[model samples]
Target: MEVLINLTLNGLATGMLIFLLAAGLTLIFGLMDVLNFAHGGLFAWGAYSGTWIYTSTGSFFAGIAGAILTGLILGLATEKWIIKPVYGNHIQQILITLGLMLVLSEMLKVVWGPNQISASPPSYLAGSWELGNIIIIKYRVFIIAVGLMVFALVQYVLKSTKIGLVVRAGVMDKEMVQSLGINIQKIFMMVFMVGAAMAALGGVLLAPYSGVIYAEMGLEFAILAFIVVVIGGMGSFPGSILAAVLVGLSGSFMAYYVPSLSLAVNMLLMSAVLIFRPQGLFGLKG
Candidate 1:
């Protein structure tokens, strides 16, 4: 029972991390209809920048803020300079973003050196709690809490706020939103920036969880983020979280019970979902 609980906690923690990354990707793809393969680059930058700031200043929150700021700047630059030209062209978006991904990775190596950087949780978050025979890691719990809060906050913004109404309406009929004297382009930029910030937040949090951050890590996790987006359905926020949790749990359990298939399990799950429900578990059919 303790083992099960531990695994569940681990899975939830992992899922939350992935959700942070996927949430933004889904929003960008859904609202902007752009395939942003370079989103992972933003994630990597967050981890690198945040870890640096954390280590230098001995303040974890400062690191997070720095990372978020980095993401917002990068997001704006990418959207305005690179993505704006390639809008409505998936092929160009794919090619250009992929190139950007490589550029971002190389820039990380140049700025941070070629070695992987180690990250540790702050003193307050470094310990574990004991409950009878069951032990729970504080850092893991912290991650879960943060993830849930972010989800709730974003959900409220999307569902209750006027901007959220505009975003949703734009997704359904961008032409109509534009026709109503609203600057849909500005909305797109805002969404993209928010998405990038979320990805950066995920990256910073993941640094301590994984114990190290590397330049190539972005590409690897980006693949998983894409997988989660696909499994949950493109442009579906609720679907992204649900799918992220499913993937996280499955990976955690599979790693313990079926080590050989741990990596392959995600692909299998995605395939099964695709075969049965092409639109994804929570995605609407186009």
Candidate 2:
């Protein structure tokens, strides 16, 4: 029972990280109708920049804030300069984003060196607490807390705010939203920035979880994020959360029990979802 509890918590934390990335990707795709392969690059840059800031300032919170700001700036720049031009053309968007992904990823190595850097959890979040037969890692709990907070915040923004209404409307019909006097282009930029910030947050949190930050790690996790997005249903924020939790829990338990099957489990899960529900568990049919 204790083991199960521990695994569940661990899984939830991992799920939250993946959720952050998928949330951004799905929203961008749904709202802007853009397939952003460069999303992963934003993540990698966040990790690199956040870690650097944390090390320089010796403040973990500052690191997170810095990463978010960096993500917003980069996202705005990319959306305006790179993504905006490729709108309405899937092939061009893909090519441009894929190329941007490479450039952003390479820039990380150039700025932070190609070698992997070890990142330790903050002292306050380090170590574990024991509860009877169960032991829980502090950092894992922190990650879970942060993830839930982010989820709640995003939910509130989507459900309660006027901007959220515009976003939802745009997602349903961009032309109508624009016809209603809303600046669809400006909304697009805002959504892109929000998504980028989420991805950056994920990257910053992930650095301590994996204990190291590297350039290629972005691509690896981006694959998982894409899977979670597909399984959860693109453009469905709640769907992304559900899918991420499923993937995280599966990976956590499978890694411990099945061992050899851990790597294949996510793919199998994705395939199963694709077979049974091509629109994803929560995705709306177009």
Candidate 3:
């Protein structure tokens, strides 16, 4: 029972991390119709920058704020200089973003040097809680709480706010939204920025969880995020969280029970989902 509880908490923490990255990808693809292969680069940058800030200031919250700000700035630049020109062209988007991804990764090496940096949770969050037969890691609980809060806040904005309505309407029929003089371009930029910020947030949080930050880490996790996005549904916000949790739990259990198949399990899950439901578990059919 203790083992199960531990694994459950571990899986939940991992799922939250994947959700942060996948959430941004889904939103960008769903609303903007742009495939951003470079999204993971942003994640890596956040990890590196946030870790640096945390180490320098000895304040984890400040590091998170810095990472988010970095994401916002980078998102604006990418949209304006790199992504904007290739809108509506999947092949171009793929090629350009892939190139950008490489550039971002290389830039990380240049800035942080080609080495893994260690990260630790703040002093207040560095320990574990004991409860009779069960032990809960403080950092893991903190991560879960943050993830839930982010999900709730975003859901509220998407479901109940004027901007959310506009964003949703734009997703359904952007042409109509544009006809309504809504300046869909500006909306697109805002969505991209928010998505990037989410990805950065994920990266920063992951740094302390994994205890190391490396440039290639972005690409490594980006693959998982993509898998989660596919399993959850292309544009379904709720679906992303569900899929992330499923993936996280599967990985946690598999790693314990069948260590050799731990990595293959994700691919198997993705394949099964593709065969059974090409549109994804919650994706709308055209």
Candidate 4:
């Protein structure tokens, strides 16, 4: 039972990290209708930059803050320069984003060097707590806390704030929202920046969790993030959280009890959902 609980906690932590990444990916797709392959590039940049800050300052919190800022800046640049021109054209968007992805990725290697860097949890998060027969890792707990916080905050913003309402409305019908005297383009920039920050934050958090950061790691995880986004339903924040948790848990348990099937687990889950409901588990249909 204790082992089961430990695995569950681990899975939840992993899910939360993925949730951070997928949340931004979904929101970008949902509101902007831009398929951004460069999202992963932002993720890699976050890990590299955050790790550098953390190492230099010897402060994990500072690392996280710096990483988020890096994401915001990159997001702004990409939106203004690369993505702006490609809007409304799927082929152009795809080509440009893919190109941007390559450019950003190479820039990571140039700036950070082409080597994997190791990351460790902060001192306060380095140990484990024992509860009767169970052991809970502090970093995992911290991740879960942060993830839930992000979820709650986003939910509140979406349900209660004017900006949130606009985003939600835009998701449903962007043209209709634009017709109502709103600057949809400005909103797109804000949403894109926020999403980029989230992805960068995810990368920073994941760096220590995985113990090593590398340029190529972003693409590997991006694949999983994309799967989670598709499974959860495009444009549904709640759906992304739920689907991420499910994928995280499945991956965790499968790795322990069914190693060979671990890689196939997510694909199978996605396949099942697609076969039954092509729009995805929570995606709003067009």
Candidate 5:
């Protein structure tokens, strides 16, 4: 029973983190059809920047705010200079963004040096809670709460607002949206910024959870985010959340019961999904 609870908690926490990362990726891809290999760079930047701020100010909240701000600024710059020129060109987007990814990773070395940095949850979130023989980590709970809030906020905005309507419509038919006198370029830029911010949020939250962070961590998790995006459906925000949770739970159970299959499990799942539903579980068919 205790083991079950622990695994559940672990899976949910991990899922939330992945959801935070993949949510942005899927949205961007769905809307813009541009594959951004450099998205992970934003994540690494968040972790490093957030950690530095937390260390300097002795406040976790400030650290998160700083990280998000960094992501927003970088996102704007990336959209304008790097991504803009390559719009509507998948080949160029892939090549340039892949190069950008390497640059971002290498830049991290220049800025933070070659050492992995240690991170810890703030004092208030450092402990665990016990309830009838089950122990729950406070930081995990906090992460889960933040993830849900973010998801809800995104959902609400997408479902209840005019901007969201335009974004959703644009995903279906970019030409139609533009024909309707909408400046879709502005919407694209906004979505990119939000996605970048979410990726950064995932990075900052992951720092304390993992207990240490390094430059290449972004690439590592970016693979997982890609998987989640594929499995969740290209443009389905809710699908990303559900897929992330599934991936998280599968990993948790497999790691404990079949250690050798832990790494292969997610791949196997993705393959099955691809074979069975190429459009993804929640993706709309054209």
Candidate 6:
């Protein structure tokens, strides 16, 4: 029972972090069809920039704020300067974003030096609570709480707000929405910025969980997130969360029970999902 609880908590924490990232990717890559390989660059930037501010200001919350702000600003610049020009060209989008990914990563080394920096949770979230044979980490619970809040907030926005309705309508019938005099370009930009901010938040949160931050970490996790996106179904928000949780729990259990197969499990799962249901578990056939 203790082992079960521990693994559940661990998986939940990891899932939430991935959800933060995958949620944004769903908006940009899934809905807007941006294919933004540089989204992870925003994440890496958040870790480095947010951590720097946290260390400097002695406040973790402030670091989160800094990261979100940085992501929003960077997202705007990238959408306008980099992505806008290559909007309709998938090949160009892939090439440009991939190149930008490398640039953002290298720029991290330039600014912070080529070193892996360690991160620690704030004092309030530094320890664990013990219950009989089980121990629950405060930070992990906090992460789960944050993930739930984000999921709920996003759902609320998507369901209740005018902007959310328009975004959803845009995703389904972009031409029709545009015919109604809606500036889909601006909506696309907003989605990109929000997605970037979510990715940044994930990065900042992950630093403490990972205990170290590196530039290439973005690509590594981005791969996992891509897998999640594929498994969850393109443009399906709820599907992303469910798929992320499944991936997280599977990884946790596999790592403990079959360490050698831990890495292969993700690939195997993706392959199986591809083979069995190409549209993914929740994907729609548009």
Give the best candidate by lDDT: 1
Question: For model 3, how does the per-residue alpha-carbon lDDT over 58-100 read when each residue is reduced to its tens digit?
Answer: 9999999999999999999999999999888889999999999
Whole-model lDDT values for every prediction: 0.93, 0.92, 0.92, 0.92, 0.91, 0.89
Model 4, runs deviating above 4 Å? none
Quote each prediction's TM-score: 0.98, 0.98, 0.98, 0.98, 0.98, 0.98
- Give the per-residue lDDT of model 6 (tens digit) for 79-186: 999999987899999999999999999999999999999999999999999988789999999999989999999999999999999988987878899999999899
Q: What is the Cα-based TM-score of model 6? A: 0.98
Residue-wise C-alpha lDDT for candidate 1, range 1-286, written one tens digit per residue: 9989999999999999899999999999888889799999999999999999999999999999999999999999999999999889889999999999999999999999999899999999998999998999999999999999999999999999999999988877789999999999999999999999999999999999999999999998899898899899988999999999888999899999998998799999888888998888888643
lDDT of 6 at 39: 79
Worst 10 residues of 2 by lDDT: 277-286
lDDT score of model 6? 0.89
lDDT of 2 by residue, 1-286 (tens): 9889989998999999999899999999889888789999999888989999988899999999999999999999999999998789999999999999999999998988999998998899999999887899999999989999999998999999999999988888899999989899999999999999999999999998889999998898899899998899878889999999999999999988998998699999889989999889999742
User: Candidate 6, after superposition: displacement of residue 173 in Å?
Assistant: 1.0
Clashing pairs in 5: none
lDDT of 1 at 211: 98
What digit string (tens of lDDT, one per residue) describes model 4 on residues 130-197? 98878889999999999999999989999999999999999999999999999999999999999999
Provide the global lDDT of candidate 4 against the true structure. Answer: 0.92
- Tens-digit lDDT track for model 5 on 108-203? 889989899999999999999999888989999999999999999999999899999999998899999999999999999999999999999999
Off by over 4 Å in 5: none
Clashing pairs for predicted structure model 2, backbone only: none
